[model samples]
Target: MTGAAQIAISGLDPRDRAAIEQLIQRHAWLIDHGKADRIGELFAEDAVLYGIGPDKIGRAAIAEWGRQRAALTERRSRHLQSNILIEPLSPETARGWVALTLYRHDGPGEGLAMPLLIAEYADHYRKAPDGAWLFAERRLSVLFGAA
Candidate 1:
């Protein structure tokens, strides 16, 4: 197990934990609501995302990627993150682990009942000069999903 995996939210100060938790929960809310333009605000200017799709670097690229994702109208999806563990490496840096579930809605008549993907994420974060925690790097590993 990595150092991040060894820490839990409960180990941190309540205020710090809450701040970190808000940063994470906001991601789900923003994506589900198609607020792509604002999504990039969650990450640092030079952040990187590595996952099943093409990796993205920098906030502009990440925001553009979100815009493209928002343009997908054929289906609606919901992303939920759970079991978030934040390990503060310093006052300005931290690592996190979270379990993610993605649910899909096929059409207007289709209920939002099917889970399309499940994954685990390991992430690094940094406190920006403005004093907000932002993702520096996010690495996602799928546990199960449709081909």
Candidate 2:
């Protein structure tokens, strides 16, 4: 198996791994569907997001950023995530990486398109008191295309 796949197979309980995966997927869905007002649900109260314009510290800041971006009605985006690998740090904490391929355009019509951003998210997750997994930190590293 590939290194990431192998590591994913071993660490974290199956249920926890699945939950984390859902959390990651939900983040992508929310962004793509313009559900910015719900963005706070995916993160810890004090989470930080780095390398997307400026660092957004705290859930409130992140939600505000999402709201502003969503207000731009002309822009459309699809965030595709893959190659997720989660490494357990403890029962309630873990770290992972997700490969992101973003296709975006403004004032859309069916036309030639290409990925606007190819990036990786280096993520840290924490399980909340209510037993939900949430992002504690998410750092984006762009490998190709626009930031």
Candidate 3:
């Protein structure tokens, strides 16, 4: 973790667990629902977002890429993230890892649907000056996909 990140979550008592949980949940909803703008809001001005198919940089680019991805698939996909671990590396820095499964009906056959294994994500988060947990960097390795 970094100094800024540490300060952001420094006072996170037990009661703040729910808030953190919601933050994570909200992140999923934003992406799964194809709410690009909403998802972009989660990132800081200079935030970096990678993975989720292909490569993207900056919050604005991420939003456009997300929108395009949703459009190209021509099918709605639900992304599930589990077993997320958040570790504080410093007062204002932290890292998170999570397992994700992406499923949709855009297979060869109309009725065909399968899970895309994103495997795991190694994310570095930094607390922005405005006190928001934004992805400083997110590295994703795809385990399996139809690509």
Candidate 4:
């Protein structure tokens, strides 16, 4: 594991940090809005998603999985991510973690549950040739109140 000192020693430039933050924001928005196909753009071509089920590799496969997940009945959800920490491992590689809270309703008339599903997202990122920060891998770990 990377120590606190290591994280303190490593830093991402403002531009890199901003790009990554934007990438994360867009990811949540796209997923919440049932635009799962667009979520693929935020990932690397060979990205891996250690999602709710088995690990999904490659952007195409990930997108397909997201599409199927989005099709699983009409629902509404709002995702809020906070405490984002990005540690630069190299000029082109970094690791990030963020706390996530999901407010969800089962259907059009269903209301959100009292206790939210609080989770943390651990991400590996790589700078692409196009100067975009893409997720190399993402794993979501729920802290409490599973949905």
Best-matching candidate per lDDT: 2
lDDT, each prediction: 0.81, 0.89, 0.66, 0.85
- lDDT of each residue in 14-130, candidate 3, tens digit only: 333344445566777866675644666666666676666666678887777667755655556677888887776654556778787877665445554568555677777666676
- Candidate 1 lDDT over 1-147, as tens digits, reads 445444443356667768788988887787788776677889899999889389999988888888887776665778888889888876678789999999978667667476888998899988889888888998899999966
**Any runs in candidate 3 off by more than 4 Å, and if so which?**
1-21, 70-73, 107-110
Among residues 3 or more apart in sequence or in different chains, the pairs in candidate 4 whose N, CA or C atoms overlap within 3 Å are none
**Model 1 CA deviation exceeding 4 Å by range:** 1-11
In candidate 2, stretches whose alpha carbon ends up further than 4 angstroms from where it belongs are 1-10
Which sequence of candidate numbers ranks them by TM-score, best first?
Answer: 2, 4, 1, 3
Record all residue pairs in model 3 with backbone atoms less than 3 Å apart, i.e. clashing: 1-89, 1-90, 1-93, 2-92, 2-93, 3-92, 4-92, 5-92, 6-91, 6-92
Task: Report residue 2 deviation for candidate 3 (angstroms).
Answer: 14
Q: What is the lDDT of residue 133 in candidate 4?
A: 96
Q: Which has the better TM-score: candidate 2, or candidate 3?
A: 2
The superposed Cα distance between candidate 1 and the true structure at residue 66, in angstroms, equals 1.0
Question: Which 10-residue span in candidate 4 carries the lowest summed lDDT?
Answer: 1-10
Candidate 1 Cα lDDT to native: 0.81
Q: Which one is best on TM-score? A: 2
lDDT of 2 by residue, 9-100 (tens): 56788899999999999988888887866887799999999999999999999999888887877777899999998998777889999999
**True-structure lDDT of candidate 2:** 0.89
lDDT of 4 at 145: 81
